[model samples]
Target: MRKITLSNGDTVEVECLSCALTSGLIESDGGVVIETDYLHAHQAVAYRIE
Candidate 1:
């Protein structure tokens, strides 16, 4: 598992599944749900925000 902090202070925790695929969720204090295969693939979960 890994945490990726965006330039806007948004966090994305993900895990490497393949070459260019990752699995995780998006954590934004600004109340937004950003979805992308870049952080969620192969049905893997590795992120949380609360």
Candidate 2:
């Protein structure tokens, strides 16, 4: 991951979520639910604002 500073002086970690998922850097729950020659869809239970 990489960190970037925003204009408000907030530094946040950055990463390519899509790339991570596809490349297996991040594992998707239940694996990929859908896929095609040009697309892929998977279940990702991530951060939740509740």
Clashing pairs in 2: none
Model 1 clash pairs are: none
TM-score of 2: 0.53
Whole-model alpha-carbon lDDT for candidate 1: 0.40
lDDT of each: 0.40, 0.60
What's the TM-score of each model vs. the native?
Answer: 0.29, 0.53
Kindly list the per-residue Cα lDDT of model 2 for residues 1-50, writing each as its tens digit.
86644333444454966676677665554579988889989764353222
RMSD of 2: 7.5
Query: Which regions of candidate 2 deviate over 4 angstroms?
Result: 2-14, 47-50
> Candidate 2, which ten residues in sequence have the lowest lDDT sum?
5-14
